[model samples]
Target: METSERIAQRLRQFGELEATTSPLYRRLAPLAAARPELVALLRERRSGQPPANVLLAALQRRLMARPEAPLRGYFATLGGTRAPDDELATAFDAFWPGELDALAGLVRTRRVATNEVRRAAVLRLAYVAVARRLVERERPPTAHLVEIGASAGLLLAWDRFAYRYGSAGFGDPDAPVTLTTTWRGTVPPDPHAPFTVAERLGVDVEPVDLDDPEAAAWLRALIWPEHVERAAAFDAAGAVVRRLGVTVRAADALTFLPGGLDALPGGLPAVVVHAFTVNQFSDAMRRAFDQALGEAARTRPIYRVGLEWAPGGARLELTTYPGGRTTLLARADPHGAWVEPLEDEPATTSR
Candidate 1:
């Protein structure tokens, strides 16, 4: 296939996601379509990479952070919280070409590094919605959490942020930020119920430190330009992680799972959680992880919770060790803005 066709295909997926999940990207989509030259430029930069948005994300990060940049005026959060849609679109039409040129220079000079926005806390909230049921089933007073692809370990501090879905609520009452998602389908387990995290640790190839300006900027860039609430939530979560001093080891998930499980304190239920991470692993690596987890289950009580995508949507699944029974708990938006609870537990072949 031609490079533009390949890039357009990827952009179409991003466009659909933006239409469903982001207000900002939805508005920018038209501009992206109108300018074939910009698409050609992005295609050239992306080469054969599937994630064409990386170039735009880097450009947005640079533009948003720089006070004097022309695009800075168009951002709602930067100058004002509101702008007319037509005006914004006009501004985009005028500004995108020059910014794309600058982006080309930035890409050539190696000023920005590629990174994905890891908002695992959204998944954490999805987990918490049904956590009481899991806790009741396992009958464990304390839960030890080990995360794969933990990124900046922001979600490790999930308990520090407040959550409210419809009328149900969870997390610290006094927390600075509150994450609200629409509830669909059946009600989730009681969010007010008690739970404890005795230990939490994350494993990733390269862990982010919020203290590093560049690293933090990349993360902020990962957020779509319009989702100011998400950016705010991330800042609040980052503060909590920094204050609490969460540990995120620099290691591969498959290699770390076995040893990490073995080192957990005995008697407490060890819960391993990962979201939108496992699919990136090689088939061999995934098999090794499953094998490792199965072996570790022999030593102690272990439960695996995965928030992953299925053919239908993003589903939450729980796997209990010893006998390896897995149950589907809920389905959610890709960003966890809404969750539809499953009334009946359905067994799945995959996590």
Candidate 2:
């Protein structure tokens, strides 16, 4: 159990972090902080998960279930028209108490697995760069795409979605989902680059099954209340995944990675990718991940495209193994709202 003081501190910090991005969460944080009973709900979170996010997601889940709930007015995703204001706290206070048990269960059992579809924009660029490198080495531009911590495997269908990077466009124009990102610094590799996803597989400890309505609703609830665009993109991507029947295997990434790579047909390289997933890993787990990649690299080349948190911010990076060389591709919004290219050549060592 967390102390009341710790809960309050976490809520305050979370509120500040959301101040610029999510108005509803930003407003609720301080209000939730002031209520000890409300803040204490975070005590049920799983180890290594952020208490504030878990608590908020729990509350949002309840609101999502009860469309008639007054708190729904504060959530734009639920067609809430009321803007963030003082009344937001009253709405939450009224709605949450009635569903305390359900909320607690959700917080305890659910993981915040946001399958942000827009991230395909960043991943597309990284894949293009990887393809260019493969072609330079006189290898096939085909890849067996394997993603770690792929929640619903929505991103695995990246090539199925359309993208617009500034004025340039790529992918199927008639695709169900179209992702656009603000591109910065130097021209991106040929948007017309040849790259093929020969196979798609994702590994996650708790992969969301889009076929299940309850599970899918929880994934939708994980999105911030104000991010209607993200919710729309998610639905579109989910549709694509269901249509394509993408596979997300339920397994721990570190343990499954080597075998997952080895299982793929030889000749076609494996492009291992992940986004906002490594932050959950422990120091030991990270080392094990590196070891797994190193072990996999002995037989065939491995390329890892990651959009993970860096010291500066979230970085879009491509690391090639056997050589262990890393290329700092760009700095990007964790949700793929924008990307600022580094313009530097691929590094000889891991960065």
Candidate 3:
């Protein structure tokens, strides 16, 4: 192979390696540190190679290119309260050299994402795309959107901030937090359309409150680092949520979904959306959810979009029905990367 191709391949391989975001590093610090020496011991004791080196490589690569000042500045100023912890950053630097060399070797040689991580990544990205498409066709007359995992319900109001989508940007780029979207193909809907949100109601086992600065910060930190857009989106979303706020309660999607009709009397005239959450259930659970959602959708004109990671990268599928019957509108890659259409114009079914 040519030198350039080889180098590109190596870089791609490196990119695939899972690096820690500030929150994740904190979570895994104890685990990674505890298992530091287990690599050699396991290799000797087990029949296969161990994962210690792989972990180290991820740490090293991230640190080597680490823009300490930018990262810190991002955290301190624009990153919200939850950007990243200094101690965690320090720990990563200290551990990088030895661990990363081994890990980098593994990333280039034995590069493969485990089934679970791959699935998670796919699912997350798929949902991310679907979320952006919420305003497609025409931004709703009222932008009030319904969210499922309203953890803190912080993102319920995402319409108010800046969104940077390469050529198709939304919101204010100069805002404290911005979701950067690198447009791969046609862009999703614009936020400036006729949509005006009246409400944001979220349901989570435990929801984050925008009023609490620490909780908000924690939420930012918890977002995956590689998906930089998630953090920026969250900030704009959080801010919007504060302005629109959210009426979040501890509830399950299956039960509350149907019952929610009462809260949205005259039936909501807005696009209702659910993303990345279908996988939270087993197949049976998913089936039951679809069934329940189908039944509830009968009450109003509901546009349904689904994102499933499955075992592959990710598939952003849109299913919009005017009423009961539904059809897959278009499937796309995360962030409008590529759209796969099974039908033209979103399928609309009415009772």
Ranking by lDDT: 2, 1, 3
- lDDT of each structure? 0.66, 0.84, 0.46
For model 1, what is the alpha-carbon lDDT of residue 131? 55
Number of the candidate with higher TM-score, 1 or 2: 2
Off by over 4 Å in 2: 348-351
* Candidate 1 residue-wise lDDT, 1-351, digit = tens: 366665565666666664554566656654565567766766445333434356556567667656765556656545535443667766666666666666665443322222222334345543553456555676655678888878888767776777777776776778876778777856554444434688899888777777888677767776666667777777777777889898989998877877778787887767788877787678988788777888888887667777776766687777767566677767877677777777445456544
Which 10-residue window in model 2 sums to the lowest lDDT? Answer: 185-194
**C-alpha RMSD (angstroms) for model 2:** 2.1
Q: Indicate which candidate wins on TM-score.
A: 2
Tens-digit lDDT track for model 3 on 14-122?
3345343344433433444444342322232212222433343244334334544333332322332344455555544455444444444434443211111112121
Query: Model 2, 143-176: lDDT tens per residue?
Result: 8899999999999998889888888888788988
TM, every model: 0.80, 0.92, 0.55
Model 2 error, position 274 (Å): 1.7
Counting clashing residue pairs in each candidate, in order, gives: 0, 0, 21
How does residue 61 of candidate 3 score in lDDT? Answer: 36
Between candidates 1 and 3, name the one with more favorable lDDT: 1
